[model samples]
Target: MPRALSTPPVIAPGSLGGSPQPVLPVTGGLLLRPWEEADVPAFLSAYQDDEIRRWHTRRPSTEGQVQEWFEAYRQDWKHEKGGHWAITCDDDAEVLGRIALRGLDFDDGMAGVAYWVLPAARGASVAARGLRSLTTWALAEIGFHRLELDHSTRNHASCRVATKSGYLLEGTKRSAAVHDDGRHDMHLHACIRGH
Candidate 1:
């Protein structure tokens, strides 16, 4: 027997892909904006950072790869699969880091959060600020029910960011992420709407 449908989907299909991704403002004179063609150099430079490279192994290396990635990011916004942003100061446009909503599922009102700050931008709570701003847009401005943050267990900084941003620790997924050294456990954290 088929069950009758009672509740509607948390988010409607095309509701996200139909609209242009917005530029978000973070406290401390920070802004999260869409990637641009001119940001290629800074974007590639981030890959050279040991911390960024180790955690985010899947990254564009060359100009061609980054170009392809830029095109893909545009398409992802249109398709509602993901949203990417460059973290920069409101006054200075130099790319300070990267942050994104990956594997967005509109029907479930869920998405994964990921981010990294440049060496120069570290220890300023940049990641936490950007994450809080994005979470507000996702939960309050829009209508997402939940957002998940996962990072390698060895990444203590990320754990701090997640907690500071109000994402409660859910649990651990053992051997979930494969870093350059080896597989590492991942800590999962999440925030629900109105919490």
Candidate 2:
């Protein structure tokens, strides 16, 4: 016969999917909130930017596709598969960027982090701020053990964001990521709980 478990799960089943994801606040009054119907336009427009499209190869060509993505994001959140948020400001409330924890492995107590900032939000440390806020929520607030972030080796901005957010450089994965330009090496970074 099999023996009963000694220790409980690190994250209870209902702990994440049971409740709504909260609006995480960043410095400079920036906030990370769930995407809404109103954000569809901005989300679509982001793909047209050369830099955004360069790294994020997937693009939503039409309103329908954007809406479909929103549905998928909501489903991911409901099932604890992922958590995605829109980075906005207190005064404007418009989408300045996005940060997400994808590929959540509750059993292993880890998740993958990803983010992008719009052109208007580029100069400020928006991505780093959003990343830090999300990291706190995922590690400290939710009790996850680690969060991993991977970006194209050529994406200097993303590397800076990960480093600025306290994600240590682990190593590079050769030809691990494919962009519209072509296959590229990926730099892996990680941040564990408790600083």
Q: For residues 1-195, could you state the per-residue lDDT of candidate 1 as single tens digits?
A: 934447777887777788888899999999999999999999988999999988887988798899899899999999989999999999988888889998997667899999999999999999999999999988887689999999999999999999999999999999998888999999999999988
After TM-score superposition, what is the CA distance of residue 124 in candidate 2 from its true location, in Å? 0.3
Clashes of each: 0, 0
Error of 1 at 149 (Å): 1.1
Candidates' lDDT values, in order? 0.91, 0.91
Q: Locate the minimum summed-lDDT window of 10 residues in model 1.
A: 2-11
TM accuracy, model 2: 0.95
The RMSD of every model to the true structure, in order and in angstroms, is 2.4, 2.2
Model 2 per-residue lDDT tens digits across residues 1-195:
934557766777777899998888898899999999999999999988999999998889998999999999999999999999999997776899989999988776889999999999897999999999899888888999999999999999999999999999999999998898889999999999986
Candidate 2: residue 126 Cα off by (Å):
0.5
Clashing pairs for model 2 are none
